[model samples]
Target: MPAWSSEMGAAMQVQIDKIFKEAAMQENIDDDAVFQEGDGVLAHLKFSFTLSDPGLKDCPLIGCSDGFSELTGYTMEEIIGRNCRFLVDPVPQEHVENSARMVAREFCIAVKDGEMYTVPDAHREPWMPIVHRDDGIFCIQTNARKDACLFKNLFHLKKIELDEKVYIVGLQTEMPIELWDEDQPEEKRQDACRAACRACHKNMGAAEQVMAKHFWFSSPMRRQEDGNDEDDGFV
Candidate 1:
């Protein structure tokens, strides 16, 4: 399995989380999603059920977890309405050719075969296999549970990477200003409101009011030296 630095993992986790949230909201709520969590990471799958009882096309994508996007490097916007083969590499080695075929046909095949399944930009690895049911609509239940000993467990590490990626999304997104907790006592609370107001007063009057929004209520960097001195005893 490939190892990523803690920083990369942290950064990726944040984006993955948002991806999962969007998946959840889209799939089960209003057919806006493409996949959902049936179980733990491996058990998660993309399900399609037709609305008009004709074919897979009638089935609207509802939701998919962040793992889906992480493995494919495509957001939900690009994935929905696309064939599953979008993730597979068009040209593959002999070993992976069969696996790709099995996935393309939507058949239940084992991943232990020498063939590799391309996961878009992520990797050209074996397709993780499970019992695939294509009788009515496309559905796959991954069989390689953590307990199962497969030759190359690609999904395991991939799932972990996706999970870590989702966790990193927290750093990238922000909440509404009013949503912040207001219960902190004065001594413990930093005066962001005061800082913001002061900024608005100062910058709003400047000739370049166009840049005012960028500087409003921005946080000041805390010096490392100040932190060190605060931790040290009086000399």
Candidate 2:
């Protein structure tokens, strides 16, 4: 092979140094420790906000990431210090089960906005939908099986603004089941769940690679409008 010139060699060395520096910086970042292994799994982003008391009027966005901006079409400047409820749309009462509504009311009792909600331990049930306390809207759904749990929790709520109209984003994550054993320990079950989550993220990355070539090449004008395209539509 031909040797690189001194100038080109120096530039290449600088680029390598920059890559290492960035990798080190990312290692130091504390957010989303669960997905920080950096084995090619997509990093999951989480947002938290503070809700007001009694009237619950001033629900300000406290934290977010660039991933959220890509998902929601709103920059941190536009979203931070603003009520997250702006992204929440009211759910129809007819669709919500009475039991879920009751659970939501109980979950919201004296709950502050910035506080994180713990997903309940419902290992016996196949599916359980968790509703947001303030809006009574379905925010998350959980499943008893490990793979099912990953599929349900992976892609979360995001609101997209298109043509000056706000629309709730939809994305589903699907993973094929390899085995179903009912006798696994709780810790073992959780490990399986994390593996499943990683698998789904990897699968999404693979699909994007294919779409970037075949689908996008076929229609150069039609780009993925938002982050929801990352999901496989299983949910």
Candidate 3:
């Protein structure tokens, strides 16, 4: 190869830099964890709280993230003050799809309705650690976006007490499609559906499933370990 002038080498380097910069920006658009925090939490992955409003009989959106708008194709103004249930698809919970699930759904509904549930005493299972789960809710539900596109939401509700105020924060993370794979082992699939929220809490890495693509308009999700990354209602 012939030796190149310093100017020629510099020109090539500039072009290479430009290409890399473009690629990085594209990846930022594709990945969800656009921002990271000093505390190691993904800012866009987790957002605001909701109160269990008795009079309204609904959990309204008290706050949210910009990532949610981008993913769902909705503007912040549209969702802010509305009930989060507006996005619930109803299909997954209603159409359990089999006899086993039909029975399970009844039990799940019961548990939801303040029945057949008791707090397990600490040390009952050495493998399981005791945690205050009374106020937190863990559920897997299908949700729809602005245009009626569907995706599974690993919905987690957290309880926070600040003096006299209690905040029930709704933390949503999109789940991977791998959970629905037909080739997945039967035992694994069954356990996913049958066990308590802990099954997915462990397997899917709770609060860390933010590595979701725009599932509706995109290819299969390549989630948190794969890469990584929310919102509210209006006036």
- In model 2, pairs of residues that clash are 51-113
State TM-scores per candidate: 0.24, 0.27, 0.43
Reference-based lDDT, each prediction: 0.26, 0.33, 0.38
- Model 2: residues >4 Å from true position, as ranges? 1-58, 90-109, 113-235
Model 3 has a clash total of 14
Regions of candidate 1 where Cα sits further than 4 Å from its true position? 1-54, 58-62, 91-95, 103-235
User: lDDT of candidate 2 vs native?
Assistant: 0.33
Give the candidate number with the greatest TM-score: 3
Task: Provide the lDDT at 190 for model 3.
Answer: 35
Instruction: Give me the runs in candidate 3 sitting further than 4 Å from their true place.
Output: 1-57, 89-130, 186-235
lDDT of 3: 0.38
Give per-residue lDDT, candidate 1, residue 50.
8
Worst 10 residues of 3 by lDDT: 208-217
Tens digits of lDDT, candidate 2, 157-204 = 322222332222222222222223466455443443454333333233
Q: What RMSD value applies to candidate 1?
A: 23.3
How are the candidates ranked when ordered by TM-score, highest leading?
Answer: 3, 2, 1
lDDT of 1 by residue, 25-122 (tens): 45442221212245222124221110010123422222333344444445655545444434333323432445434543422111122223333322
Query: How does residue 31 of candidate 1 score in lDDT?
Result: 21
Score candidate 1 by lDDT. Answer: 0.26
